[model samples]
Target chain A: MSDDIGQKKGLTRRGFLKSAGGVAAVAGMAAGGVAVGARDGLAAAGSMPKKWDQGYDVVVIGTGFAGLAAAIEAKNAGASVVVIDKMPVHGGNSIINGGDFCAPGTRLQKAAGVQDSPDLMYKDMMKAGLYLNNPELARILADNAGGALEWCEDYVGAKFTRLNFHGGHSVKRANQTVNASGSELVNKMLAKAKGLGVEVKTRTKMERMIANKDGRVVGVEVKTGYRYPDEKTGKTAYIKAGKAVILTSGGFSNDITLRQIQDPRLTEKFGSTNQPGATGEALLAACMAGAMDVQMDWIQLGPWTSPDEKGFGHVPLFCERLVGYGPMIDPATGKRFFKETGNRKERADAIILIGHPVIIMGDSYAVPKQVFPRALEKGLENGAIKKFDSLEALAKNYNIPLEAFQKEISRWNSFVEKKKDDDFGCMIFPEARPTVTPPFYAARLWPKVHHTMGGLVIDKNAQVFGFNLKPLKGLYAAGEVTGGIHGAVRLGGVAMADCIVFGRIAGKNAAKETAWG
Target chain B: MTRKHGNIRFSPGWLFAAALAFGVLLVYIGTPYAAPKQVASAKAGDCAACHGQEKVFSPSHPDTKAMSYKDCLGCHAKGGPQMLQGKLPGSHLHQLRGVTCEKCHGKVAKPEAVEEKLCRTCHNAEKLVEKTAKVKPENPHTSPHYGTSLDCTLCHRQHAKSENYCNQCHKFNFVVP
Candidate 1:
């Protein structure tokens, strides 16, 4: 029986190659760099395995928010689905993310009495994205984000108990999870996907997207039992997708080589707020299979990260929370440099141009009210956030000019009282109090590479577009893997919204594809 | 006497077996401290079976040939500086407790990497979570991200030194044993 199966496999492989000869010749030249390049394509293009080791109706790569959502939706659509993650654990960066889902016109917004709509959210995204966003994709994200958030809270049994605000948005729209961590949503989604009978396989890395002769992605070549970051480990295997393959593998924020190739300024000097496995191999593998990429250089640096702490540490929570409630000061001159409530890009660029870290400070009143208790406690414990009994002490601690610092504090207090800023047009909330309160809390701010706003180009349906500007057959992409959604900048809480919104679309569409064999 | 001598003549199969045995003997002698052999009935302190004549302990150390895990615990008490939990490789403790190589790896000529299922046969994951529930900072056995599904070998390596896998992203500073 084994010999007969082996003979049949050999015959099929030969037949496949014979039919794919023309495409294989072209793909061979495209994949020539794989032999000499250190970080290039994993497999030669058009190199389908002799036999498929596994089969599923729809195969999903990545186990992040998008991947899990896609897997659950695909499984619910009555298609046999499998989700693969290279990491030993599921929930890529989604697990570690700050739990803020921005959706307009939600219950949280209504209760908070914050007027918001999908149109306003779209405007905020487009403005922050510098009008470079694809109108259709942005519209889809805005329109479906509310439904997706509802699905997360109602269908997946995740909780959003608080309303928050991000700098780019016009009003309070971010619905924060109860635990203040994305693990709440991602873990729930993971459970939901598993309960739906979708096979979730961790430590299985995708090596290549296997496309048929006519350029339809039929399956994926993967490494099973893979040890992450160890290329030599795991055995080569193939998983045939009878219908389609969804690429939800996240961005290349931690991929120094690839990020530098796209943006030379993003060198090793900048630390990334991403997991170690947030690399670009899977995205490049898709590219080798004919998917086109867009805006590959529009990488984002978070302005609120601290050099004192590691990877997206507690300082971000502190800084983001205190933005509208306090003032940001340049330690060198002891004065306000930029708008305290400016968007991430503006703030990060301002700090980068300053050539040193700046300070974001809030009084005791603002600190206790605005900052999350755990974040404030952890930040103080780690020495990333410092406490001062007086403004003079704080200024002395940061080596700021005491006189100029006092003058700036008074100026900021005046703006807060008037609820307006004439200098940088800083937004002051109605509840924001003057900085006259004792016991100030402050944190040093430095930029870190946070997100990449560029990846495979996909249409409104989350169908991956090839270099020919046509939808790639049997290939769908969503979340950070696909570009043109956020364009130049992704707003603070929009990633969760973007991932879920498009992920469901991709999953349902991928499952609806007719089986090729 | 002539018939007896003729009967003692060696066959080709016997000669081949003799040569093979001699080759194995040479290899054994040349590398005394080679990869451990699967000696199921060997005592825990019978280091000579695996280490040959290599000095596994200090010269002043007491003879451990007859000592069991409990006997060793008399000197290396829990929480003591010389505690064996983190010092010795986990396999040694298992061996001292009378768990032979065959118990986990099975009676195979060449033992490959075992999956977490083999460990689960002995150590229950949910029970371990309950046992370590009060560990400071966070429970090492379970987490919100992976829950209790992390591979046992990730933190409790048997052959090599153990590691705290959570320290990659978190500063839990867990003393993983």
Candidate 2:
């Protein structure tokens, strides 16, 4: 595609080189149109190196939950493994993530007396995904999620101390980490991987995947000492992956250009919940090396995020916790909008359709009972979540019409009293009470790009598939880098489960691949 | 006739390959690479020592060639109209306080980036957190996520413009120095 543009623009690679002179001419070629596409701008997969600067049996890209888990498993499976990340810090988004790991039939679930099964989890995922999910991959994720969580707790020594509920779930299946952050699990996994003799190298970035004449991935060109968001900070070197290379570099929620290619609505205007390093270059590099992508347009938006704060702020904790206990009010109309307890896509879409930020509120009773104390205090401190002494004060603060807002609150109160939501079909929690208490708490909700549900297609064994309907030899993938596990929309807390389960599988299978070297 | 340079053989194929290789090399080395400015002396008042010929301060500013840290506070003091605390590089403050390159990086031919421990020697993390505990919006020194465990280098760059690294995910609006 870029070649055609180059040809039309009279700036072909060879022509530019012939027209200009020395090393300075190269910069002119870059400025002209020698490189248009992302892959065209970089080295191709066919650029096989005669020598390597480094060698590993399994090369894992990224150091988040998935990459660390993959490195540990590959090392345990008797393969010399190396995990690399471009960031200065080890953990990516996983470190700052709200520690919610969803799995069916876990110890936490058993202790919490929440009856859940793999079948129920699978059904919920399919229903929320709109059944676009590849059944086999989704089934593998569902069946193995519990085992993965157990491995994290038992083997990695990460604690799952509480069971929580998420939207689009049959039961309270999400197991919260002890520290309420994914760092609890990720840090443990990093320590375990390091203890197992797996080298975790930060500031190392993958430049491009190298494929031999047989069209099999053999190694990767990398740059050491790489800085995040800076393409030129690292030193170039080739790392030969004798066994295989596993791509777990995560999704493109923060890549405006890449995300817009899939979902046009996901422009720069949409804020992202992911770290800035969650770009799609690595995934696209895999595609250039013959990997097939599935459902690239299925980007998920978190409706609970507040526009007032940055990234995935404290408002989500308040908004998500209060969903079943309160009502989502459209400030303009001062009425209940969509079902407060709907799946992320549904809720985000409903808010986007309104073309304005909406409000979710709970009284003093639900605020203290449902919301985490720290989250509430921090949210109030940031002015994202506000407290009102009365419903009148709440309406006045949000510029909501007093009469309609009062009527809506009373109508919502009646529904809460009867334990049924006739207005928006919102699932009123069993323990929820009327919002009659003084000091109401509320937060404004705007959607933020959360997860990219489409990526490289992978099989049950986590082997990346090519356009030819065959496994891309010497290449494996797991976590958000692979698609079809969540189909159209990934449920909350399922990301950690997917990463761990598929990461372990990818590592084991990649280690078992015949060493090309 | 192909242009040959040093050990490289320059043919059409080789030139194309070199162009592509140089393209790849530019990405690896990072474009617009600026070598660290090396000051000849440890004196605080040598404006042209590290800055070279680059005009940093406004022309209307008073001459500061021999000014000390206390002398800098004459106009650019704390709570002033043009405070240099968060605006200037951390290295300038370090130099003004007599902590030269050797203080953190030691006497080396090529001084590299210092460790977090170097900063912790003078600025205790816990103490700093306590000091900024009452800063409005949210505390910049500590956070609920990482607390004070985040490396000071993430925000307080010595040579470059200090950034609020927390703004990557949150709108903390911290004026980092």
Candidate 3:
């Protein structure tokens, strides 16, 4: 099936390399074409190494949710699998993630009496993604998410005890882990994978994909003993994958140089919520190996992060909970600018347009009721979340016009009382009360580069597509590394679902591939 | 290229210039301002052998030539204001504690990176976790992500300044020693 596409393209490996090199040279001379140029230039398949330092049936890049899930599934499928991470530690951004696994018809959802289905979840994803999502891939994610969640629970022994709501979702469907962090799942998955005899190595970075003369990916060139951010370290080595290689190296939100190349507005001025190792080199290396990328410019920024705290701090928990129960006030005008329940992109863009930090506040009633106690406490301890005894005090702290802020609070309270926002159509929850309670809590809001919604293009089966618009044989990808799942923006909790659902698929299919050797 | 000097055939000016250049080269090589040399067999207190007379201690500091780890603790006691717990690199601490370079790196002429298992030879992972269980904020020895399996070098860098790796994403103010 894969060979048919390659034959139809009618370009042999030699011809393809020549043409790609020519195109890269031209692209290199053009302004703002460095990524494309580098991709094509590096895409030239490497010469076969005389010896392989290590061999496995499946070699997975990254140790995040997707890579670990893929390793476990591939191992279970009877393949000798090896997972590698460039970082010294295992779990990538997955460990630091706020564990919100969005799946429809979940046990938690049912227990909470919130009706949901895969179809509803699919619609919400499409709506938030601006209809740019690959419908087939998105459908696969929606359909398989429930089973994946069940696997994570029943098979992997991870616990999900809470049902929560994220903005842009139809209902409360996020199945949050007991610890409220993705480490609950990732660490469990790591243990499970290791128990199944899967070899996991850290500080092993993939330098490039090595494809055979037939244009099939056969292995990867790597730097063993790698010290990250120090390219001078690590010894060059090769690892042959007898069957296939899966790329789940994740997004490039923290790569300031690469992010700015894609979107000039994403300068160093904007902080990122991702781990320091969330760079684009691995994804680019795949692109260099004939993989095609899409929607690289549709980077997602989190609207809830604070400049006061560092990467994905406790303030996000405080701010995300306060939305809809209170108002996000532009301190300059003391007015609500955008809808509190709007999607991530809309809220972030609105804040970016305002040119400075804004405020998201909830009174004592909303704060204590909506916010997680631990997050609230930590945020207060860190001084990211501040308390004010009265509206005047809140306004004084943020330098908001006291009289105008007082009037705005009254107007917002009226909206909450009526369960409607007449101004910006913010979704006012039914249980929300007036913001007249003393000792209101508020946090400053500034957008941080959160997720990159674009990456290597992949099919529904998790096979990566090449620049020739055909499956790149022996190469599979899932999670944030593969794009067209969440189009323009990724809804808050769907990333976990996407990684697990497709990661399993990639692993299984990668194991099933006929050994090229 | 031959200079026509029988026993002293070079021009007098050139001879003087050559002597001056050689003296300058010797001074440059002898000065401690260059990179510090690593002498695997040197004593922990013999700083001058590797440092080439570099002033590593303050002028008021007492001589530490014969001081062992216990002897140094008289003035630099644990938890004291002058404590060297976090101030000194882990390698120096290890040296002071009598774990010489050969203990982990072996007697190889060129020392390479040491694996975590070597660290486990002296510091039991489970015992360290138990020892630090009562640390404020959270225990640094074990975390939800890596548990007790995290590479010790990630936090306790031997040759370099140690850092709390958790502070990259979190605000854990651990004085990593």
What overall lDDT, based on C-alpha atoms, would model 2 receive against the true structure? 0.85
Q: Which residue runs does candidate 3 get wrong by more than 4 Å?
A: A1-43, A389-393, A414-420, B1-43, B107-110, B133-136
lDDT of 1 at A514: 98
DockQ scores for all predicted structures = 0.11, 0.25, 0.21
Which candidate, 1 or 2, has the higher TM-score? 2
Task: List, residue by residue over A276-336, the lDDT tens digit for candidate 1.
Answer: 8899999988888888999999999999899888888889989988888999999999999
Residue A300 lDDT in candidate 3: 94
- The per-prediction i-RMS, to one decimal, reads 15.3, 9.7, 20.6
| Candidate 2 local lDDT, A281-353, one digit each (tens) | 8998798788899999999998989988888889998998898898899999999889998878888999988
Clash list (residue pairs), candidate 1: none
Considering only chain B, what TM-score does candidate 2 achieve?
0.80
Order the candidates by lDDT, highest first — what do you get? 3, 1, 2
Q: Name the runs in model 1 displaced over 4 angstroms.
A: A1-44, A324-336, A362-366, A387-425, A428-441, B1-40, B46-48, B52-63, B71-75
**Candidate that scores best on DockQ:** 2
Query: Of the candidates numbered 1 and 3, which has the greater DockQ value?
Result: 3
Worst 10 residues of 1 chain B by lDDT: B19-28
| Two-way DockQ contest, 1 vs 2, winner | 2
Model 3: per-residue Cα lDDT over A349-379, one tens digit each:
9999998999999998999999989889988
Scored against the native two-chain complex, candidate 1 gets a DockQ of: 0.11
